[model samples]
Target: MGFSSRTFLVAPDDTLWRLSTSKFDRMLRDPASHSLPTFARQRARMASVVVELVASEPMRVMRTTYSVLAFDAEGRLDPSRFEEQQFALVESVVAPVIASSAEENNQPVVDATARFIAQGGRWTPSPALARAIDEAALEQRPCGRL
Candidate 1:
């Protein structure tokens, strides 16, 4: 399938804000440039990676409900083939940011995923493809940490 054709959802636990508060639109609008929102920053990094991996196609999303849909090259979702794309997206985009920031904290992203999987986190692709497709916008922004 073409790059933009498949749709996926962002896990609630993996929300970008949960990764960093400095990312809060509210925070960005204000004057006090405080410490980087570490979680948000890291998550934002991961989110950027995901978009890059799933590049080229346009993604439509609903913000309030956080629903996302990507038009597959074939215009359909193949359940068996979905996870590879999902994992790759997660690994490519999200992992580096996780590696970059929380690398110091030693936060267990893989562990978290393992736990989620252990808890029966099925591979149901979300209709919402996890908004924030602008990797350029995000990558251009400086990370608080190296």
Candidate 2:
């Protein structure tokens, strides 16, 4: 498999970690290996996770951050899903696509970010979601984009 071009908006909290490890464990057991379906599932899962974080705001921030960071280390996202998909992964599946035989954890995130931005810059968080986070922050909850 090759790298997929995608970007995601994940919530920042513990739920993100839960989603990542769960999916990573599942992928490790997937005998199908590197196929489109596996990648698609991971991608969908990542989207689900991010959307959830986006919906919850401050309460889920830390988990969302960890999830994004972890996935940022290993999974590829499905860019088009940013504004379309609902119910994303509890965390995220961010990482690079690997061939069946490749084990190197050296994919450059800078390159990936560059590519994502080149494709369409960063995703603007939904205005409503941003507003909610701001309100939560004022209440000392402090939810920000992850």
Write down the worst ten-residue block by lDDT for model 1: 62-71
Please give, for residues 89-108, the per-residue lDDT of candidate 2 as tens digits: 21112333432114455443
* Stretches of candidate 1 exceeding 4 Å from the true structure: 1-78, 106-146
Best by TM-score: 2
Query: What's each prediction's TM-score?
Result: 0.20, 0.22
RMSD of each: 17.4, 15.3
lDDT of 1 at 112: 51
Report how far residue 94 has shifted in candidate 1, in Å. 0.6
Clashes of 1: 13
Q: How big is the positional error of residue 5 in model 2, measured in Å on the Cα after superposition?
A: 23
For residues 1-146, write the lDDT of model 1, one tens digit per residue. Answer: 12222222233353332223233332324314422323231212223222222364433322221222222333232223334444544555556676668768877555455334322323332333332333222343222221
